[model samples]
Target: MIPVVQHQWKGNLAQAREIQVFLAQKVILKPFKIKPETVLAVDVSYSRFEKCGYGVAGLFKVAFDNRRHKFHIVSEQYYTNSDTVPFPYIPGYLSFREIPILLPILSQISERPDLLLVDGAGIAHPRHLGLAAHLGVIFDLPAIGCAKSRLIGDFLMPGLESGAYEYLRTNGKRIGVVLRTKPACRPLFISPGHRCTITDAWRLIFTFCDQYRLPEPLRRVDLMSKRMRKQIEKK
Candidate 1:
């Protein structure tokens, strides 16, 4: 597998291979008043011909009412790098290549977020470590990893509610959960990043998930990242 781990943010291929444990490490095992004020989501795009992935990060604040939910993309960052992804596309080290760029963009936000919703895993990893967990560790902020597919663990099955979830554990340790977002829709791979427990992660994700499979803040960000990538490729 490729082992690209960049620390200098120089877009160097060699730097992208320094496999480190994680970039962030704040673990949130308890619950707190999770206000849906601000959230951030990150996604990367690769140039198949150039052998590199460009990262585009989006941070949006939620504007909610009794009738609906909406968001405004207040900040975004796009950067190019030669990060050769290592680790066989595994968990734990996902943030090594992507987060290096993401963290820089996140740090520049004018307002600190109440919560961050990552596009990868949180605790649902082979090492019980995912991108969200890594970011939480580094930032010491409450965060969640919401993935579209399963990375590890086993569960009985989720219900048809918007927030129904089943715990995902490995080696007798609770990692993440298989959660139902919309009734009859595919489940999301959810996990706590740091300073958060399984239950808190579930509550937070369920709240932001709202009526979409992903949180309003992140759902739009995902589309924004794709657009950024397309623009970058066109250049």
Candidate 2:
């Protein structure tokens, strides 16, 4: 089981931002090779019933066969819990609102993944730590953040052709990439979370993209989370 550091979730906005600033310092940016046999992606879906909300974390794994240079789903897991959201929906502090729901899912996974991908920003955040970076530091796992929209940083839109990209720059430093995963589709904001550099994260995301705009493992978990919410709501 992956060890989860014990931390409280309830806090005010100032307290939440302070924690992010502290954890942001712990994020590491270094080059590392990421040939993985297993990769995991996680996402959470929320539904409300009266005063409480149900949050379900959908964790999906993809295994790569080196010989074939292909990837396929190996397993999927889901963990659900209901609670009033402890933190308000504030910019730059999403991890505080979402991490509590995801930790149980991470701890209960059948196999630890070689890498973890999250559907949010990493070091590309205003505080240099988003959901991916936060979880990566807490777990000390190799993680990457692939966000659908720009959270911070300036970038020129990448070319329409798939695989095109432009660096996301902040004060002349490249913090992430605006990666075009499919022709004519909006680019993904890619950033390193922990234990990997920007280039390492880019290459891994490109390899797993295959025929879709989003990486396969990340896409799978997103769908899984959305479907889980639908099923739960129907009951």
Candidate 3:
């Protein structure tokens, strides 16, 4: 999809931080959740060489019933792209390094999703504009961040049960939630990217997980990215 708002991507750490500060102001934490008929999950997998990676996006049509509170995946579409990383990976500024490689894949998706689930952080970043937030602002679409690890902030461990969560705070402001997606597994860090609220992100993340620690869309795309990267490297 074409970005609704385009901005330069190549920059130094200082410049990246400045962009983050500017974009963070645009992130809307308001409750913008909808009964989405489609969702897209995206992830990028790196090769042994840090400067090359593959990106994959999976768009799925879904049906959700409030009475059952269940989501059924009706259909799926996939897209993939490989690119040479333009910048070195830096903590808290990962989007700068990865987004350049991922956008091509995102732009080629056959269908636009009602919601975008990013395999990264949102307001959970030190600058409050992580990968998800950055993409949401650029796309002008609702998005959520479902991270495997905490990029910043501190919180008590959530209970050892599915759906348990605790608020993650930074300087007395709530930024995200530590949500348990499966029993006896590590919890995910759920955060609002843009046009979505913390609670909405949490609930949708739980619904997407279905029976795994990672959401189904994320899981499938992660595997696809890895496979794509390997195939590209072999060529």
Query: What is the C-alpha lDDT profile of model 3 across 1-235, one tens digit per residue?
Result: 8888777755778888888999999998888747888888889888895878788888888888667676888988888887888888788888987888888877776566799999999989988999999999988889999999999988999999988999999987889999999997999999999998999999888887778899888888888898888788798
* Error in Å for residue 176 of model 3: 0.6
Task: Rank candidates, TM-score, best first.
Answer: 3, 2, 1
In model 1, which runs have C-alpha deviations exceeding 4 angstroms?
Answer: 1-26, 63-92
- Per-residue lDDT tens digits of candidate 1, residues 1-235? 1112224444443443332333422244576565556665666655555355555555555554445433334454433333544323334456665764565455556665677678888877765557777666666667788888888887768898766788787766677888898887999888887666777777666666666787666676666656765776687
lDDT of each: 0.64, 0.79, 0.87
Best by lDDT: 3
**Clash count list over all predictions:** 27, 0, 1
Q: Pick by TM-score: which candidate is best? A: 3
Off by over 4 Å in 2: 2-4, 48-70, 74-83
| Stretches of model 3 off by over 4 angstroms after superposition | 65-68
